[model samples]
Target: MKTLNDLLQLGDPRLYEVCEPVQENELPMVKEWVADLHNVMEEIRAKYKFGRGIAAPQLGIMKRLIYLNLNTPSGSVPYIIINPVFENLSEELFELWDDCMSFPNLLVKVKRHQSLTIKYLDENWQPKVWKVEGAISELLQHEFDHLEGILCTMRAIDNQSFKWRPTPDSN
Candidate 1:
């Protein structure tokens, strides 16, 4: 299994392809991917202060999987969501400035819902549901887009409209 340090970043064409649906026979591989993803997130969090989430494509895997570790005072733990589905998205949208590991350092303002209800399988393969709002919701939408071969850059309000910011530790 590759550590987070070894995970590939975005911009690789592999990140742009649609992932195959998870099958009963592939459960073991999916579990392994989840483990590796958690390791990747851990590595990222150790180096960066605010890396709360990551998607499969960000790791060079064209699969509908994501791992998020929302930072909270109590301490954060990773949540692995496989083949996630979003529901109850509001038509009422908000424009949040965002960036991607794939497009590194570029920030774009993209439209997103303020809240969402999501359904996905947990690590144990049991059905789980979550309702998220605020920045977390935006993050999920951003990661989910990767599964569909979409990038925030494509939805930029306009060319030259967004700004680029370096990662937290960049000098």
Candidate 2:
């Protein structure tokens, strides 16, 4: 099974390439990618104590897919979003520190739409739409950008907004 041990970092040209849309007939292969994403995201969250979602490009797979393992009061719920695209975004926006699996050690202060609705296909190839806000909204945006070869660093408000997360041992 593919794991998180080989996540691509910044400067990798592959990370800048847009992903191809997944098709219904590709579910068999896509399922495996979802599993890999789930395992990798879970492991990264446990190890780094960060990351709520991840995109396929981060794992060197240039596909329009993302996996989100959300922890709620009930239990953890995993999502496999395929070919996700924002249908609408609120005019209002908010700024927050954004991070990515591809660039784990850096935090870019970026602006995102305050509210957004997205259209996507689920693992079953069923169409779905969702409203998102707060952190998850930003998370989805960040991951979706990966599908377009856009990184959080590219959205930095300014050069000053790009700040690296301090290493644990540096303190």
Candidate 3:
């Protein structure tokens, strides 16, 4: 029954604070956070039918953890990125419209690297590295920014590029 209200909104200052690296003992709570994230995503998907990922901070848990339920051409793949850090970024950049659960009704036009290398710990606390491009790469950047207390609005290319989310009828 949990929905987007479970997520922290844009005005919450806690979203601006950098999250701490999750520790071993925090697994129990981390799991709960992950569950909450999944539930929120599921609720959103059932209604909106689209989502990619979410960060712990979005749930008001200031830990360096993120969950992704990606819909790939092959199939759906779930991910848990703990304490993620970008290893490299491509020189190429592209502009795209981005949205966030924190500010669900707004879309921001932002420029991001076309591709990048990222390293992080999995849900099991195991190390993981990925060379991501296109939508996945963009998705990671958006979620990662939350760990640094940055929002898509902050990443917008210009004041004019920011916009309100469109109604389904408009789409």
User: Tens digit of lDDT per residue, candidate 1, span 45-106?
Assistant: 56554466778877777778887877688997678888899999978789878877555556
Model 3: per-residue Cα lDDT at residue 76:
87
| Alpha-carbon lDDT, every model | 0.77, 0.87, 0.87
Predicted model with the maximum TM-score: 2
Best by lDDT: 2
Q: What tens digits encode model 2's per-residue C-alpha lDDT throughout 72-145?
A: 99998888999998967989899998878777778999999988998999989999999988878888988999
What's the residue-level lDDT of 133 in candidate 3? 95
Candidate 3 lDDT over 58-133, as tens digits, reads 8788899989998879998999999999967998999998988777778889999999999998878789999999
Which sequence of candidate numbers ranks them by lDDT, best first?
Answer: 2, 3, 1
**How do the predictions measure up, each by TM-score?**
0.85, 0.94, 0.93
